[model samples]
Each structure stands twice: as C-alpha cells, then as structure tokens.
Target chain A: MLLEVYAQTELRSRSQQHGGIAACLSLVLLLLVVSPSLAFAQDQAVAIHLIDMAQDSELSITAASLADGWYDESEDSRVSGYELSDGTPVKFADWYHTDWPDTRVDLLTQFGDDFGLLWGFSTGERGEKYTIDPSLRVGFVAQAHPAANSILSLTVRAVAWGNLNEQTCEGDYGEIGGVQTVNCRLAATFLPPEETLQYLAHAEPNRLHISLSYSASF
Target chain B: MTLRLKYLVTAAVAALALLGGASSSIAQTTSPVLRSWMSPDIADAWTQGYKGQKTTITIVDDFTSSSKFTGNLGTGSLLYRHGEWTRLEASMIAPLATIKSQSFYSGTTVPLAAGLNVLNLSYGMYARGTYSLSQLGWSAQESSIINYAKNGRAVIVKAAGNDGIAIGSVNAAGNKDFLNLALVGAPSALFVGALTRNGTVANPASLASYSNKAGTNTAVQSHFLVVGVESSKTGLAGTSFAAPIISGYASILGSKFTTATPTQITNQLLNTARKDTLLNYNAATYGMGEASLSRALAPLTIR
Candidate 1:
C-alpha cells in the first residue's frame, strides 16, 4: 500500500469592506515530507488532508448579533457572530470551512501504469466585494518505481479560476469640427486591483503548477 | 406742491420700485435654492458614490394649509409649500436617498420605515412657557418622535427655531418650542442651528442673526450643531433649511456605514464636527460646532 499528501498555502494583503471583496489568507506554510522505504512493492495510494490553518488580522469575528428590526435583537441559533466590515457590524450567517478531496487515475491502461490523468474542482470562497473561485486543477502525471517499495511521480497541472471582469465599458462622445463621434472606454471597478499574493489568490484566473511526489508502503 | 415735496415724491417711488425689483429677483429663483452653496465635502462624498443610497428621510412639516394633507401618496395630493421646500433641500443634499413627505397639519404621528431612517422636523410645536412637556399634551406624533430619540431608534434632526434666543427658552413672542424641550435629553436627537456662511479658520463664521443659540443645558448643548444657511446666496433662510442639510448628511453617512444604527450615525457626525470653523466657538454658542461632512467621512471607524 502507498500513501501521499499535498497542501498549498496562500497569503493575501488586502482587506475590504462589507459587500466588497474580502480575501484573507494565512502567511504560515507547513509541509510534511515522507521518507522512502525500500522493502516491498505497492499497488495503489490514498491521500488525506490533515489541517488547513489561515490567519486574518483586519477582521475579527464576534458572537454578538443585532435584532432584525431597525435596532431589534435576534434570537436565532443559526447566527453565529458579527461580520464587522468597514465600520458596520452585520450578522454572520452560515459560516463554514470546507475541504474537497482530490482524485487521480491512470489514463493509459492499455500501455502501462506509468501514465495517469488528474482532474478536480472546488467551491469558491467569498470576500468583501469579490468571490474567490479557489482553483480547478487538471493535468497528467508520470510514475516510476525508485525502489522496491517506493514509487515516484511527476505531475504537471493547469490551475484556473473564474474571476470578476472588473473592467467596465462606458460610452463617450467627442466633437470634431462640429461633428460628434462615439467612443467607448473601459473603466476600473469600485476597488482598485492590486498585484499582491492575496490579490492573486482571489482574482487570478489561472496558473501552472509542476510538482514531484514520492510514496512508499509502511 | 413745493420743489422739495416733488423731489421726496420721486425718491419714494424709486425706493418702492427698487424694493419690488429685489422681491422679483428672489421670486425668480425656486424655493430651497442653495445648490451652489452646498459644501465641497458633499461633492467629494458624491464622487465616492456615497449619495445616501438605501436610506429614507421622512420630512414632517407643513406641506399644505389644508388639514386633509396627511402624507397621502395619491396623485396631486401634495401641494408645494414649506414641507416641499424642506424635502427638496434634503433630496438635494442626498440625491439618492428616498424622501417621504408628511404634513404636520393633519397629524403629528408618523410611521417609521425599515432600515436607516432620518426624521426632519423643520417646524416645531409652540406653546406658553408655563406648560411642561407633560402638560403640553403632545400628540401621538410628538410622543413617537420623542420615544425614537430617547431610545436611539432613529436620527431626529430638529430645527433650532429662528427666535434668536437660547434653545428651550421662551421667545420674545411669548411662546416656547416645546419640541426642543421634549428632545433635550434624547440620545440621537440633533438641534440644527443656522450659520451666516461656511466657516473656516481664515474666515470664521458666526451663528445666523436669527438662529437660536445653545442654552446652558448640557444635554441641549451636546446635541446642537450649526451649519451655514447662506440665505444671501440661496435666497432662502431659516433653521428650517438647516435641518434638511443635516438630514441629508445623516443619510450619506448611512450609505457609507450600512450596518450602523441611527444613534451611531448621529454620534459620528456630532463627534466629528469642526470647532475651528466657528467664530468664538463655545458649547453655549456653537454647541458641538459646525457640521463637517469631510471630517465625518475621514474616520475609518466610529463608535
């Protein structure tokens, strides 16, 4: 039997107001490495995630809730805390964190187990004004036996996301020699886009990842 | 007639024509014509797209002389008058805010709307000074407004009357604005007084000649705010005009701070008022000081 694991950490910098894009990411990165064994041969492998830890400094979640009316109090169990954004405190509803499993299989059964394919998609996380479509990874893998019990694999994956097209187009006119001409121009959205890693984690449409992994039987 | 008498007659006719011409000049302009007098801070807020969206301002004032006009939404129901002018002024300040007109002549009671609400009371209830709040026999409207103010349910912007006396004091006309008396201790209520013009350090502004000053009462002093009326520029005058400006300001603040309570919004404005803009600034004279929209918007967080 063989076992494998993979994890990624993203750090974002911008904190936005409510109804605005909010992408909060952690800075710490932890990776667990597996040592290869040279005892017996292995057939199939399975992987599971241990933990995903992220930190947010700008916004702190609170447990107090305001009532439904102008300034009424609410007695709802579903409401966990308050979402304090920009300066307004709103009720935080249905807060959760989810992790989906990643799957891969051999595509070339007629040739050998050395060639495989990978495809996976996950749900998007929300921010102030923007919703982050995490990542959709799809690619191929190459496998080889480095030892009697250990197997090594090389994978090349294309990661893509659905980001907002914040470039809005507006019509304009100019007068030239008593004649009018219509010209369309693209404008920036409410919040300006940044080039930080946090912005990339939320707004980046696609990227390429090439990774190498090795696994062995216990 | 003598030559001197003829000269005097000609001068009298000239004076009458000049006075008529000035009246015509003012009449040519529409009511609440203070568009040019709007502060640059308001424009800046607009540029940032904070024009009081998702907020409602209820103008409770004299819409018509008829007792039948009671905030009815039917066609041709609202006749333009004092209430209409106040509504226009408030709408001009916060163009995106939803405005509801209610005539105080019919009934004093008003229904509160959902979300952030700003109540503009440009007109006050007057009575003899010997009477207390309990003895004033406030109608359901006054009671409701006072309750909202005391409980921080909504922002209540009341016009500091044009009597040129201290707030809650009996005027020379032997009458007292009981509304001011009832609202003295309210948490989110604001008494808006008029200034002669926009004040700055270089050209500090004074309270309008006709505006009521903040009295010795600490509660009234804490809730008072003065804004430029600029009647000379707008061809409109009075604390009634001043109240709508604050109402609009409260709406814009609501747009920015979507989840803030009416009390929070009110406190934000009062806390950020500019003292340097008022001439001889004092709590008894200027109260919190001139309402500064720019300074109010500059804060990242407000309690």
Candidate 2:
C-alpha cells in the first residue's frame, strides 16, 4: 500500500513539475499530511513497563492485625503458669509488652495503573503457627485497583506455595496430638486486622483472604 | 531516581512500619478460655461435622433450676458463671448441645434419663471433712448426682471447687488448695480445674492460684482435668467456669462418638488430651491433662 501511494505521488509530481514551485509546495503539504498517519497505522505499540506496570499490576498496601493472643503474653505469672501464687504477676522493670502489627505491599509490573499480575509479601514476626512450619508469606499477588491508588488484594503468599495452602495464614496452630481427628477454632479479633480488633488473624489461617488499600506509585 | 520519587518510596516504607503497631489499645484481660488467648482450635470440631446435635449438657450449681428464663433460671445472669452463665459459655463451645439446668444447693433436680448426657457441676458442698460415697448421706437431690456417678450413661463434670483449698493437703502456694470435701469421692466425676492457658509460659493450667487441686492422698487428681476459662465477659476465673467448657466438649464428643457411653466419652476426652503444652504438666494439677476437644476427636490412626 505504501509503495502504491508513493508511485502515485511520483507520477503526480512528474506531471506537476511544470508548475515548479507551486507543485513543490503541494508535494510538501501532501507528504506532511500522509506520513504521520501512515507511519502510525503500521507501527505496533509495544509498551515496555520496567516498574509499576499498568497491565501488569497496581501498587497496593494492606494492613492486617494478627490473631489476638496468638502473640499475647499470658497475663500475670499465675495465669500464664509462671506463677502459682495469687501474688500479682511481677512485671519486669522492662517487661516487653506483647504486640506487633501485620502489613503487606503489592507492586504491579505495569504502569497503566489499571490492573496487572500482583506481587507482594507480608512482614511480621511469626506466631505460634510457626511451631509446625515457617508461616511467613512472600510471592505473586492478585490485586484489583478500584481507586486511583488503592489496591484490593487477595491474600499475599509466596508463589512457591500455591494460593490455597491454609497454613499460609498467620496464626498459631495448636500442637497436634492423638488421632488428629478434630481442631477447635477460636476467633480473637475481626478480619483484616482493623484498629479496634488488633488481635484478629488478618489472613485466614485455614483459607484465602481479601485485603485492601495499596497505594501505587512509580 | 527523582528526588520526589525517593521521597515517595521512603513514605511508603514509613507507612508500612506505622501500620505494624497500629492496633487500637484494648484493656486486654486474661482468660485461658477466651478464644483469643489459647488457640484451642475447637472450631475444628465443628468442621469434623459435630455440633453436639444429639448431646445434652446439664449445668448443676447453687441456684434454683427452672425451664423459664426467669432469674429463677439458675442465677439468670450470664455473669454469675453458674447456671445460666454456664449455659451461655457452653453455648459458645457447643452452640448446638442441649442445655439442662439444675441447682444443687437449692436441692432441685432435673430428671436424668437416656441419651448422651454430660452434667457440669460448678458448685460443691462446703461441709468440711471428706465423706466416702458409701458412708455419706446426701439429700436425694445430691444423691441423684451420686446416682449420675453410678449411672454410666451420664458424664459428671464437677469443679474441683475453687475455695483455693486443697482436697487432701495444702498446696505449694500454702493456700488451702484442695478439692471440695463432699465431691472428693465421686467415682464417675471428672473434676474440672482452671488452667491459665497453654502453659509454656507463666502459669501452669493445674491450680489457677484460686482453683483447687486434688491432693496426693485421695488420688482424686487422676479423675480431674483442666481447661482455660478466663471469662472475657467478666474476668471471672474459676473451675466453676472450667467445668462447663469440658461439659460442652463432652457434648461435642458425644455428637461424633454417638454410640460411645458417657464413661467412654469421659475417658477418651481425658486420655487424648494435650498435656505437653502445660508447664510441669502434673497429673494432680492438670489431672488427665488439659481438656482437648481436638485431641479427643483425633482418629486412632492418622487419617
């Protein structure tokens, strides 16, 4: 198609050569008008996103409070089995208070800001669940960017362990004993680790979880 | 990187760190029982498809027993940690188990018959000096409890009694820490004691300072068990509260081990408990170890 158009232009130019300067002006205008659109039509846009890609992913932040008491220090020595006497639980001059927050981040590979493959990891000290296996999550992520900067993320987990392993959840599992027929469940806090209920297992220890508010940038 | 971009990255990292300690302050109280402190994982029992469907749990305490929800319904308030209160806690555990209320001090009785019945006795007679079951003469109401002990169909879960006193001797804490004298000899009873939590930490589950433990002399300790029950609702701590959780667990076990007799259910729950979690894990203090619904429900061999 381009060759045909060029040949036609050449013929027209040859015919209009007699008009000289006027013809030259016409040719310049014609060439100017046709080149850009033609070039554009033939070009394939290969968007290369080195960081925070749009189709690849959107930046998201998640804050989940861990399971209550999963990290709690038993109150007083007697209650925790440290002290048998009702004598008040002796507090160390610096009794390290029990507390820690759970948070994660998801970074996409695309800059389009619309959506992309999710990749993120969680950061927090492991709780009792670690007794069985290292329960920290790191890996590929799935996210939906519903707002300008907010990303709604499914649970953050290392890609090594597919998305379905229940142990990937953050919380303590009681030491298994006997025939292992039953497991009792106890919920100490709200899901997603809201401020009021800091003790909740932010991620489902036995299931997948959806979480929020990841801010994406460069 | 642009200066602005650097600032943005720094801010993001800072925000994440801020979120780590962002949980609002809760005047956290203690309870080995609150689903919060100890991860008993009782919810696993439900997944095993047991919700105490065919099980019945009876609460025997100091108040009068009545069907209606009047204050007459055995200390009507859930705060009493007695009848109604116990029913409330048991519901938290079993959710679907049948709740039967009776009063020992009031001399009232709820007729006991067939089916998987687990009685939780949170109250005990204060009359001093242990009495052998054969030599004792309790009112038929009390004797009926003895009858429950004799009846193999029912599981009796009584508090080791929380006078902080010992049954046959004083404890290391020098408290009168002993099991209740009146209940010292019930053959079929599993005396409940309050465990603080899984005691790899501060206190063992055995004698919660305020809870009574069976002394060495009676060997009644062999028939006791411990459970965590720091009432999140009311900081109320005692074996009185502990007994009901076991009662609820017994009912849940009944739901699964349908044909198992009450004695079998009782023994299975005690035998399969997870005591390794407790510090000093003594039999006298923790009894048949801590009441573990999950361990009891475990299959004989790996499934």
Candidate 3:
C-alpha cells in the first residue's frame, strides 16, 4: 500500500511542475507582446500649449512746457505702458520697434505646435506721426479618455491678421494769393490695426473626433 | 623628208583620237555625280525583275482599298495619279500592292512567300481602354500574323499617323468613342514617322506637320521608325509617303539579299541611317533618324 501511495505522489508532483512551467512561459509571452505596444504608446504622446500675453494696458507721457525751439514731436510724445499677462511694462516707442507691441502670440511647450507661425507687415506715413501695430494669436482644444491612448483635438488657430498697411495722407482747405484767400488744415496720424477675424473656419471638424496618433515612448 | 614628217603628224593625230575615244568612254561609264545622284545600273537591275522578290507584309489600318487611293494600286501610276510626283525618279522604286483591309477586324491573313514583300499601311487607330490584343478578341489574329512574320513571311510596315500628338495620347471622346484602332504596345509592329529631305531635325518638312512623335514610353515610343516621304512637291514629307518609301526600300533590300529576315533588314536600315544629322540617337520626332536607302543597300550591292 505504501509503494502505491508513493507512486501516485510522484505522478502528481510531475504534473504540477509541468503546469508551472507552462504558466511561466505564457506569462513571458504576454509580456513580450505587450511591451512593444507600451513603448509605442509612450512615443506617440505629444504635449502642445498656446501662450496668450494680451492684457489691458495704458501709457502716460509728460513733457516740460517749453517755448518753440524746434521741439522734437517724437521725443515729446514718448510714453510707457505695461502688459497684464506677463506684467512686463515697456515704453510705447520701444515696444513699437520691438516684437512686444505685435499682437502675435507664441506657442510654449517642449514639443512644437502642429500649426506653423505666420506674420504680416505694412507701412504708411500720415501727416507726421508714424504708427505700427503687430499681433500674434494661437489656440487649441483637445479631448482625451482614460480607456484610449490618444488625444483628439480640433485646433482652430489664427496666427496673424490680413490687409495690414501703413500710409501718409494730408487734408487742407486753402486758397493762396487769390482775390479771396482762406487757409485751414487738419492732419492726424493713423495706424490701422490688421483685420484678424478673417481666419475663422466656415466649417468644423468631424463629429467622431477620433484620431489614432502613434508614437514611440523612448 | 616632207612625206615622212606628214606621216608622223598623221600618226600622232590618230593616236590622239584613240586616247580621246578611251577618255570619253570612261567618262560616260563612270561619274561620281551620276553614281551618287542615281545609278542607272541599279535602275536597270530594278526594271529587269530586280525589284523586291516575292515577300509578304501586313498593313494594320482602316479603309485600305485599291479603288479608294490610287497609291493602293501598287503600280508606278499611283504616283502620277495622286500627283505624288511626275515620274518614277528611280526604277527600283515602285509600290507593289498585295492586300488591303477595311478595318482592324478585316479577317484577312497575309501570305508569307519565300522572298521579300512590303506592306504599306497609312492609317492607325489609337488603342484605349481594355481593348488589348487579347481582350479585343484579336489574340488569334495577332498570333497568326506574328507567326507569319516570325516564319519569314513578310516585312510588315505601318505609317505613323499625322496626329502631331505623342502616341497613346488619344483618349475616348465625351461619348466614349475610340479614335484609333492601332495597337499601341504590340511588339511585332513597326511604326514609321515622317521626316523632310532638308535633313533638319525637328523642322517640319513640306509634308503635313501632323505626323506623330514617338515617345520613350513603353507603348507609344518602342515601335517607331522614321522614313522620308514626299511632303511638298520638292520631295518627301508625310508619314503617308514615308511608309511607302520604307516599303520600297525593304523590297529592294529583299531582292538583293535573299537571306535577310524582315527584322534584320529593319535593323540594317536603322543602323545605316545618318545619326549625326538627327537631333538625338532616337528622337520622339524622328525615330532612328531619316531612312538612308543608299546606306541600307550598300552591303547588298555588288561592287
């Protein structure tokens, strides 16, 4: 009876060991199949952000009252102002020459935005004072679900304005050296802002908004 | 002394007369200008049954009738009848009519005789859609014709059309009607284009400027040859006339060299052509340059 019991025990032990080996092999195979897919998912994930700097701002200028000694109109009219978003205050004339006065916004992220940057420029002279206005804009909206490994986004962006121009014009109502002579002149500086709403999309993206973006994790 | 001197003078005159006679005979017999311009001996050989030997050719075109066009008669009269030229400039040059078909489907089998025959076709229909030789139910017909040529049956020559368009450019009209029936990519076929006697590359000869250009592409460009045909009265212009010239040359070569196959004859003719006169080795405008009959027949001529 003891010999039969020993033989049964040996058979059970061998079967259990075989089952364990099979289970271990299956686990390794599962890891092998899923590991590459995980790496691919990680590679595909890209983050994009739009930075807006536009804010309420004002400028003030002060000049000493002086007798006419050929005062420089440009230097006299200089003023300073601050932008609310970044809290960076700047001079009006300096800002006009620099990129800060331009309304164009920059995209801030380690990974670049999907859309390209665009710019426009125009120039004109109105009587005496010269004005230049530049602008930049960018925005995007994305949606993601926990079950899915991709982000779907309908990105509507307007980078720059169209029909920007600079020009000089003069107005005068005067007759010189005639029988009856009267003189009147009115001239004002003007810098027209570029029209920005021209970039609006007439239609929207698809209703499903499901896009499979693939990338590598490493 | 006086009598002896007279006799010597007479002898000198006689000798001079003999020398003059010999020189005149040589001049009459051999002049480079005469040989180059046209060889009467070659013309004689052509007149005395030396024109092409009995050969066969297949003309793939539409509306070929012995009655419709006088050139279709295969006689020297066609030249005068159509005002193609005043007279046969050369004796060996004549169109020999063998067969005519009204359509691509004309169920006529070209006969393959022992010697050389020339097939002159002046028409071509553009192939479009799925109407390949097999698809259009012409496989058997094409096979039989190809086999006949392969067996040294005939020298098949066709006129490249006067469309001025590259081959394979013809498309179906709005109503889906086919413009041409010529097979575009068939291997056995020879497509001939037209060139002028002025030997100007890309210049339009007096002939109609409508002759199509060959392409480097597979279908339209591969099966193309160019030969001189009378385009204007001056001499040789259209593909119509070019086809017949080739046919005539093939006949001449076939008569001179009995052992040469149709493909061999074509190769010899193309190889001997004046390549420098043309724009490129093989231009879409002129395939293998202008046909040089003298060069092509040089090897077969008995010195």
Candidate 4:
C-alpha cells in the first residue's frame, strides 16, 4: 500500500505550509480586525461568547473562536443489525467516523458596540462517503447591551457546503418490468426503505443552509 | 506518515491474519466454500484449457527485502505476509499463468509484462484530503501504473480499501485513496470489494463489514465488483483477499480470449457480472455486482 507515500509527501507538505495551530491563530486574528459582529449562537438560545468586549468607544471583536473539531456520522442502525425478509439478522459493515478531523474558524466583529457581523468557515470533515465538505458562512449579527451584565444578539447566516464529491450517493437503475426503475435494492444496499431514503437524501438539490439565531448572555 | 494510515493498514492486516490464520498450510487447503468463491466452475475452465496458460499476472505489493525472496514460484515454506498470501492465492487460481512480483515500496516503476498483462494491486495509494487527478503528485511508479490503466495496456485490479466507506472517500484519518481517483475512468481497471460470503439470488451475499462500496460515482461503479471473501469460513479476510480472485479470473479470461485487449477482458468480466448473485444488487453499493467466472466465461468474445 502506498499509504506511507502520501503520508510522507502531500500531508507533510500541507502541514508544513499551514503551520498547523500557528497558522489558524494568525488567520483568526486577521479576521477579527476586518470581520464583524458578536457571535450568534448556532441554535439561538444562548451563545458562549468566547471573546466579549464591552467598550463602545473602540472597534473590536466580540467573539472569536478557532476550533479543531472531530466530525463523524454513525451508520444507519437499519444496516447495522437489521433482520432480512427471512428473519436473517444481518449487519452490513460499519466504517463510520473513520475520517472526520476538521477545523473551524469563526470571527465576529463589533461595530460601535451595538452592531456586529459574523464570518466563519469550516474545513468540513470527510463524510461517511469520504468526500471533504469545506463550508463558508457569512451572516449579519445584531447585539444590544440590555444591561451592564447582559447581552442580547440576533444573527442570520447563509452557509454553503462545498461541492467536492458530487457523486457521493447517486441512485442506480435497471430495467425492471420494461421500465427503468431505481435498482436501489441491488446497487447500493439490499435494505428497502432505508436505501431508497438514502439515495433521495443525497439527490437533494440544495446544499445551502440558511439559519436565523438569537442569543442572550449574562 | 500519519498514524492513521499505519493503524488502518496494520489493523486490516492484523485482522486478516488473526481471523483465518492464513498460513501456507491453510492457504493450500482452501475450504469448499472458499474454492467455490475463488472461481465459480473453475474446474470446467481448467478442463477447457483456459487456465491462464498464455497470461502474465504482475503482483505489486510489499515483499520482504531479504534475499530469501527469490524468483522461485514453486510452493515452498511461504511466509505469512500480505504479499506472500496474495501471490499464493493468485497462483492457486491460475497456476498455469506466469506470475511476476514487484515491491510497491521499492520506488521503481511497476513493469508491465508482455502478452495479456494482468496487474493485481491488492493495495492502494492514499493521501490526505480529496485531490483531483491534476492536483495529486504522481510518482514514477504510480504514473506508469495509471498510464497502463488509462491506455488499456493491462487489466489493473485494485482492492477498494477496507474502510467500509465509498471508494475515493477519505478514511476517518482524513486521507483519501488517490489510487481510486487515478483509475476512475481508466479504460481497463477494477475496484474489487469483498462480500461476507459467496452470494446467489436464492442466498444473496452481503458486503463484508470492512469492504468499501462503489458509492454514487457512475465511473467508479462501472468498474467495481464484489466477490465473496468468506473470511469466517476461509480465515482469509479483507478486500486484499477478494482482489486476487478477480486477478486470477482476469488471467483465466485472458487465456480464453487470447487476442482480446485488456479493455475487452475488463469489460467481459464487468459486463457479465451476476447481479442475481448479490443481495439487492445496485451499482451504488455493489457496483457491477458479484463476479462470476462461469458467467464471465460464457461469452465467446467481448468487445
């Protein structure tokens, strides 16, 4: 296996060039200067403001975080130990979360202590299908100093996932009953509903995500 | 080298060795289930003098660097290494075919033997992240092999990794199998996956837990195949073991189609793969379906 060959060459080169943690920190600092907004929480209820600045007189970053995250998706349980039509308990092999090391850098810039903007990106981990999913997010952030000890924020962002592996889960077809039918039972997996649903999900026409989040912190 | 690659390859090799204890003695004494999966109706093919007499198979893998590794193909005390096992299996399937050996780590280009060359690559080349063919830095050896695949100079059979992910997908360690990308649209190449056991419509086989699938890529699915590795029964596991079966089939098919180009031989095996032999056979998961020597040989000539 040439596993070692690539490990020694491409990965090593990329590592050297990126300077790992140092490079990420530098990029975060640079973004903090020009980017905008207090961080809006992902689900909107409460935001963990990593960097909070209260001075309205100075231009500063309200939230800046660099996370090296591990992303992994578990296999559908149906394929794990489901019973066949004849009661044969079968478990298709599971190799989930085997390649999900990821990096995310998010920066929020505060303008005059009341308004902010969020800029973030994730070097998406390889999904179960083995494709890298790097994504970019751009959003508007609005925050108010409700009290000396409290902060409230509203955020709206659009995220676009990279289109790297376009053929990740394409449905295959064969002529059945003189008509081209999804050969889902054979080409992908033998499981019925699960396989069908799997193909349909991958065939989804949209890869963009739009979210509106509001956060409060004291 | 990343710890993940080492761990994966090592883990797979260790698992294969531990599962079946595929010693030389065990390898020589294949169980009935394994024999059937290795080549369906192989005896018939042998009787017809299509036992790979005119074919040459080049097995490129990691071999022992010691002088103990000789040119002798005769059954001796075989080492319990991966390359040794693959070479033994390939020869057992096509005993009359001339087999050549090369070490992937040697950094030398894999040589193509004259006349019906079947290159059995039971391993893959991997790199971190997804890279287009243009972005990947191909070594001399890889370039040669990719050129052979692209130009239809030989039938390249590659094991579609044991990560249980889709072919060309990055493994959990964040590395992609660039070899899969390199051969995606090649004129004559195969990505062999392993079935847990031999499959038939009446007794359909499921994929081995560790075998990579063809995924949704039409080009990849077109060149992918599944065969029973029967690890529990045979003690030999992994797509590494599944690949030799196809390599041997290619050799035998080459013997029958003496004048066929590598592309024809590849298409013959792929076009004749038995979907009925697989469980819910679809191109996404099973690719072209289970490879059947009996079916692949049924045709007199292929385009």
| Model number with the top TM-score | 1
lDDT for every model? 0.57, 0.46, 0.36, 0.57
DockQ of all predictions against the true structure, Cα-based: 0.03, 0.01, 0.00, 0.01
Q: Write the per-residue lDDT of candidate 4 for residues A172-198, one digit (tens) a residue.
A: 211111112231222222122122334
Q: Give a tens-digit lDDT track for model 2, residues A1-218.
A: 11211122221211222356445545654664465445545343311111111111001111111121123222221111111011122221112111222223233332232333445443332233221121333333345666664555543334222121112222221221222211112211111111212322233332234454455545
Q: Whole-model lDDT for model 4 versus the true structure?
A: 0.57
- Residue range A167-194, candidate 3, lDDT tens digits: 2222211110011111000010000001
Arrange candidates by TM-score, descending.
Answer: 1, 4, 2, 3
Among incorrect, acceptable, medium and high, the docking class of model 4 is incorrect
Q: In candidate 2, what are the lDDT values of residues B1-303, reduced to their tens digit?
A: 000000112212211212122211000001113354333456454433346767788776434323222111122233332355566667667767777776443444457746788887665532223323234345556566666776665888877655455554433433221224444555556877776654433444444766666556444766778777554433455666677778887887777656677777777766666666677776656666776665565434311
Q: What TM-score do all the candidates reach, one by one?
A: 0.52, 0.47, 0.38, 0.50
Worst 10 residues of 4 chain A by lDDT: A57-66
Interface RMSD of 3: 47.3
Docking quality level of the chain pair in candidate 2: incorrect
Encode model 4's per-residue lDDT on B165-274: one tens digit a residue.
99988778676667778899997999999898888678899887778999999999999999888655445677877888899889887775566789888987787687
Taking the tens digit of each residue's C-alpha lDDT, what string does model 3 give over B61-164?
Answer: 33322212223222322423211221222222533323333233343454444555555554333233334433333223344555544453555566665556
User: Candidate 1 versus the native: TM-score?
Assistant: 0.52
Error of 2 at B33 (Å): 13
Off by over 4 Å in 4: A1-218, B1-37, B65-79, B130-132, B300-303
